[model samples]
Target chain A: MREARDAMTKYGRKAHAITALVREAEVHRDVYVDPEIFELEMEHLFPNSWVYVGHASQLSKPGDFITANIGRQPVLASRHTDGSIHVFYNRCPHKGVKIASEPCGNTGKFFRCPYHAWSFKTDGSLLAIPLKKGYEGTGFGDTQANGGLSKVKNVVIYRDFIFARLNDNGVSFEDYFGESLSTIDNMADRSPEGKLAVMATPIRYMHTCNWKMLVENQTDTCHPMVAHESSAGTAVKVWKREQGDSTETPMAVQLYGPFMSPYEFYEQSGIRIWPNGHGHTGVANSIHSNYSDVTGYLDQMVAAYGETRAHEILGEVRHNTVYFPNIMVKGAVQILRNFIPIAVDKTLVESWVYRLVGAPDKLYERALMYNRFINAPTSIVGHDDMEMYERAQEGLKSNGNQWVNLRRLYESNEEQDVTAVINGTSERQMRNQFHAWAKFMTMDMDKHAEAAE
Target chain B: MITEKTITDLIYREADLLDTMQWQAWLDLFHPEARYWMPLEWQQQDPVLQPSLMYEDLLLLKVRVERLTGERTFSQKPKSRCHHLLQAPQIVACDTAAGVFKARTSYIYTETRGDMLERYSGWASHDFVEVGDALKIKLKRVDLVNFDAPFGNIQLFM
Candidate 1:
């Protein structure tokens, strides 16, 4: 297998060759289609990057835990007795069986592996082993090296959103995200109490396409007007027919109509590209800006923060903020989408809606409505996007086009400070993502350390 | 007096309308204030408090049907089709004079588009009311057996 992988030049799968697949204006299609490249991503990209685990609200109580995957590794994030969040590998050191089998539950005082009675505390320290006498002469020990759950190297909980990285040598969270952390801050700040609680269950939708396609689509503002014409466009026609000569538009129309917004509107909204493949659309306004005012919601925001601060929070309207690789957060709408790669050709997307604490019920209801209308498995608007993704997955198999174009507005872009601003329809986000992809894919630990030294 | 047979017939007719892609007819069967709800969790109480798989009023349902029938809707270019295999509906509550009728049915619904076909087994509970001699759907709550499982695009009404 190593020889076959080492000899890979068909799609440029070698170390030096991987960077060649991504260029300034275009990317080789194999990056999205090749299983070997996907394996490399699981190895190099996902582990080295901070992946979202769960919201702190999920582990609000002691012993509360959620099981998630940081790339290919199954991990458990739990609230310890000390009130700190801890992430550990889900594997039981005894028989290598998964300690926590369910997605989420309380671990009580400690996690007792169902396979064996070997137990570990919420902090992942070895607590008690039932058959300790048998291992007295053996080499087994109670420490992490022998029996306890292995803790993940790095875990960061920024403003209640939890993230874990498998490797300690990778870039720190602050260095990796930088200004893009504001997207999370913005979402949390919408609450009068300055906190966001995730709804209990997420709407999980499986996509028959590569995970990158979903990430790219979040920032691909150009496609909505064209791809959603069937769903969002028809919504306009229906509203017109339903309210002939009437000036009033319904809430349903308000939700679905913006996907058919003209190109000029999106272009004027603008896009902000941050470093490390992170970016968001709607510098001035977005589809979320037009939502009708929720009763009493503004009053709560005003009471929480003074008028000026509240205005600053509400005024900063942004659309899908791609956190690079796996997650996208829409601060304007309180929606977070985590894209979990299942296979080379399959991805599972979990869409979570957060409730702005101390806000009116109507606001959270609207968020839920938006989740149903746009991200649910039964979403009419989401189906069109899914269709396009599936089509792209199937079409990329052809040898006719070796490269996928990301040339739109690549040449001329204005950069100031650590961020760049481009037209909303520009493909700069895609190019930025590919740049990060190549960097992560080709990174050498030895070289990185030498450079740091 | 609305008999059990009449209630079962109405339930069957609703399923048939969906299965045959008679969206307009299906829409007509709904009361003006009708709500279609598919709860996310088992025995989920409040659709407003918790997120639901689907919870839509008549207006939203109309928009979905409109989109389904639209020419430009590319997802429907290869229009999705469905078949409902329903068990005999049991008339849970029948109050003829007061104009309140309720029925429960077990259904296996299959939706297909292109080469992908998904099968879902669920229980459909219907709340009905008489609107000028016609029974109309006030609420249709569907509880899928695998409601918590990860799913693909469910393109049609179930």
Candidate 2:
């Protein structure tokens, strides 16, 4: 188990030993702290899996582009003149400078490298070169092989949510996401027009911990009552003091009340885990279940999808659907959070709120309020969680414990199944995420195509 | 007439309340329908449609104050502390008929907890209403210079 970790061991063999860090119900601290393991994850895990890049709405107009990262590699997505979206390495082929320096903007007719001004079409094909006559005899050419932005291997737009995979070595998009794509679909279906538009900018928060901690915390339903007691618990006390006699719960209380919900509330909500590190923690109920109705929003949804379908869509309440390795979405609330790992101990979390097109503006306001209340840098609830993550990062350095436990409800986990249904507080989702992590990090790239199937 | 000194004094008092962690006393400075806004974008127009970093009415502000003072709030165990260094405030507008006045102050704020400290420079724009010789905050908008940068936990009000 330890042989492959030897300093002199070959790179390929070293990854095989990484699986040793993860066990049935325990994960070694090195998995979260080791620089070498972090490098391996960037190389093997991020490139092979379909990581979300941007929403199609962001690139609705031709020549519009946005810059993002796949692991450590900087990439950009742009809508071409032909109306097709393309994801490419943001690097200019000449002298390797970034083509787009801004967070997002329209590239006009084409992207021009700030250094030396080598231009490329929105499709990432090299269009023009400065002083072309000088390069006639040289190896430089207009073709992509000579000078062009390299394209990512795969790009999938499922219900206007754009996802890109850096390498072509792993599972097909369909095989990887499977039924988990429904979360995106569910979000779009909430809009009366069956469309969702992302706010132009996302509110980004930095976490001084491994990115996986945020992903795991999404489905870890037990923490809210305990960890958020200060924020939510205080809200409960204040509500009882101010509005105890009132029959109608105010919107603020309705939003903050669920954080103090008993463990049984989550258990009854149910947790479902799907293949490839995808899962959500709600079926019958969630924190989103009790939100006050926005007047006429339901009627618009009913007009779009008939009464029964509308009710079905509205009734589908999910709290945080983790799309393996990077993205998490709250379908019921129309918010998406992407976790970008900055280093072994630092991660950037971006929260984006979406507008349900055709729904009442009041509903969108509620979503915006929720984002500010829970995810903002100044958020009362978010600060507590940030403290916990930072503490975990510091505590992992202690020699007293080499393993972090995930044994809650482990005895009943349906280990052999592709999908598992269990109580909301189960650690099965974390286990599922780690299993997928091991598969992506350790398995041979050649075998991934078949392994996913 | 609301003199510049009178408005500046009131603004300074507000900052003093915040710096001393007088959570309840600071809460009393705001009118019933006051809004505390920290816009996420440059020249952000619609707080309802666009997402702001901090947008809270009096109720939300009360919740924040309660949480900050809560016994179980682990994040505040170390007690994040902040200091406001403000440039001389300028009274931008005075509408005597409406009993409303606007003041803008450029400030450099620093927050520290344990070993970590963060410095933020911004303009705090305040809308004040005179009520019975007392000025109450109708709105306090903070516009940080790096409003778009990814930020760590802003544990307390800026």
Candidate 3:
């Protein structure tokens, strides 16, 4: 371990660790099982990156707030009187007590700290202090930083998808995300009004596994055929039995049965890996290719966007897009999921369904069905993935195999870069992620050291 | 007067069938067109418009049964054992002319699988209709106290 530490440089130390663990085709089990590494991830990757906070639509009006977390820090997001969004630490500046207790609520005008009676504006600017002149000349309220509820270093709202970074030393969210930001735009553009909003409260479930497992599973096409064999296969069998010799199945069956698509189909789906560790697979022509059309919806879209533009908008379908560290989006169904790592082995997955504003009732209904049928805690498909994730976490703690293989389909004919298109079945996405993980962990060490110095 | 005692007896009888895993007997309690619903929201009023944890017609119910009892249902491989403890039911409403009756009851549904046990306690309301000779369930709604809370995999009916 000391010898590995001796190879340390501001940038090159990560390279040594990267080479030792993540390779072109395989990764070591220590990444998942080690407590020290998890701490490093929380410190480096989560707060430092452009982490997703919540959507602007969720904080509808001034004073509407939603409390969320970035890494281990409790963060609060709200809309101020100026109609701008603010993401700040949820703690009171006085004694560091939590300001809001609920998941979401409207703070109306200002937030009054329940503990010390200190008040702050919706944007977290300190409003008024209780007992005004207690410390007349003691540098009280002398500096803005010392007075206000501290703002997160950066908050970016790209077409309603809100993101914040605890560390200010990163690129713009657009520059950081690159082409992957289009998934958000495409989701919003699907509606006739060219906007999207979250409908209903999100359905959250817990996975007894490390958080990374859930993130990687988003674009993993290999497991659906096997892991989801029971639920997907059951849907197909039951639909067939009910239909006898008929060629058509119910929409529910159609939605689920596609998980059992032939390996050849997935191979043809194609995968897109962004240089920034973001990736997604082709999905416009999926099992939902022939999903029943909602009456009057297309015409409404055409009326709003014209024929050509509407058809182009309607034609685009990208399945699940992993927005790097946080957020997984299923474009067709409008289900977005992100995981909160509660502990070393526990993760809470929050799944939010979206409503394309001005879209027909049927469209939102489909999203609701997709969310209820798959993302809900009672979902059979989610159970299968959860079971595998928990089992993997358990197995990694064993002495049987020190290496978890990502070697499948890694022998590439495709050109490799930070951003590259590959076969859907290839493990390139997972490899791409670890490549970023190594970089984030190693690079942030220099920052932490500088902070210490 | 059909009597509250009879209603309580019927509710307990239905529960007994569920605890004992008598799927067929439980099915027999419901009318052919009955709906069994568990709304995702706390006081969800409309299943069609709102999301629901479960909204099953007879066909869907049969499919759930098939999956739970079938040979290859991976999650239910070892099967789930449930014990239902019901308090005496109270009649909420009765319309003899329309042959419709509604009763409210509370129960604790304990499900054991492998080495884990989960208890779901909730108020339930059964809307019944007099079908020919006996009572048949028109609607069965489980207002789970934890409906607003997240849950693990729920393999058995509440």
Candidate 4:
């Protein structure tokens, strides 16, 4: 596989261009606009790391499948007849066609390729191929490593969260996400059943900028007050009208009006950036901010785990956890947003809200309302951010500014290796991502060579 | 008998109110329980199970109207001007005794905001209720032609 060395050099050369500036807390616009760098990111970065595929609850039954993508590679998660979840490359080995084309559906016993008559099991092993009598002497009849469909190499499921890698020999999922699993744990532990159900329909929307723009914006505490002031301010006026001169601020105001918070507020909010490019904020704000506990729900939780444990579980208020390359978990709202890269200038973002099992009905309803009012494509808040993303992509095309700034808190917070609890307003999260970005993009090609041998 | 022309004329009045940016006047035309829905999926019957582009009741619509007319709604900074062109609506179903009817109308919504001009064309299904010689909107559901294929900045109603 390594005999033809031309493409590897191109990948190396394209990646080197971004690697030079990313170390200095600065990245050139070419990384966001260049086609070669996009391909290199797919080849070098995504395949070597654990990219989130789908949640286990998405594949509810045997033969149920949900399709996803890792970088440019199409993948699907399917439940086997034996009741285990597996991730595969989603292609027939013979014709290289997509086995299941829909976003999700049941394969009903086995997968039959629509183009050809090739058939495979739910786990992607070959079941049947037509006209076998003609190829007795030919090696085409032989069932190789992949019988009919090519199986994905590495799949790791951590408590219903499924992740897969297209290639091998890299950081495992557990090591890649060190202490960040606690965030996931805190989210799942909210349920008395100690799990979550994918309750809402997933929303897929296209962004007109590079995927990293959305990633960086996840923890960007500074841009909100400036970029979203228009929408948030409008929401506040409307809320005040509803209150009819009452001085009491509504919880709905905090829900939509937090975008008007100044830099000083975010600075005191306590942002924590973890290793492996995981970071989060909004811990200062609780989901249980304004409401008294619902009847019987708290007692049910207490009955399940006693009082202290229930309080601990309900007290977790994580805002956003961006897991390196693609996954962003908004724990407070129980929503997961994944960014899939299509090209250098385009991205597809899919978000799904999870319902904590055995939790209060109002709790799930609040999350649903938040999803509809904030994340939906036509949402008032999303209208602001989407416009900014499109404008940012358009502005980056200009040569006026070659380097995008990540210099916020750059000098004082120079300790790159250690996880630090910086101010919420710091750009440390963006820098932290680029730190992992540099690592993944410039991972030693010698490792690939070693694997080839 | 309530003719199709009567329903078509009523719809045209509603469109005129929207195009003229008379949102409050248009809001008054609907019943208190009227639902304005634009589904994300084609023929999505229930708004509870499926996500929607716009699913605003009277109170929610009032809040949105306030925002749209506010000073700092940046998405509306340049202001959106709408022009709705519709074919003659057909009365699909009717119950004369119950004062209820359903009309199917197709429209082209041309909107100009800032320097960009975008158009949204769709089939609109309206469930109307006649009350004391006046027709009030009970439910207005819009099924966009590009309901699946997405576009940018869906500002005005179709």
Cα deviation at B124, candidate 3, in Å, is 1.7
After superposition, the stretches of candidate 2 with alpha carbons farther than 4 Å from their true spots are A1-13, A142-147, A244-247, A445-453
Reference-based lDDT, each prediction: 0.86, 0.86, 0.79, 0.78
Model 4 spans with C-alpha error above 4 angstroms: A1-15, A141-146, A245-254, A286-288, A291-295, A444-453, B1-4, B69-71, B77-83, B92-101, B108-121, B129-133, B145-151
- What is the C-alpha interface RMSD of model 3? 1.8
Write the number of the candidate with greater TM-score, choosing between 2 and 3. Answer: 2
DockQ of 3: 0.55
Candidate 2, residue B38: the lDDT equals: 97
Per-residue lDDT over A40-136 for candidate 1, one digit per residue giving the tens place of the 0 to 100 score = 8888888878899999998989999999987778999989999989999889987888988888889899999887788999998888888778888
Q: Residues A228-324, candidate 2, lDDT per residue (tens digit)? A: 9998888888878876469998777788889988999999898888898899888668999989888988888888899999998889989889999
Our tally of clashes for model 4 stands at: 0
RMSD of each: 2.7, 3.2, 3.5, 3.5
Clashing pairs in 1: none
Ranking by TM-score: 1, 2, 3, 4
Which prediction has the highest DockQ against the true structure?
A: 2
Which segments of candidate 1 are over 4 A away from where they belong? A1-13, A142-147, A244-248, A412-418, A445-453
Model 2 residue A202 lDDT?
88
What is the lDDT for A301 in model 2?
84
Q: DockQ score of candidate 4?
A: 0.45
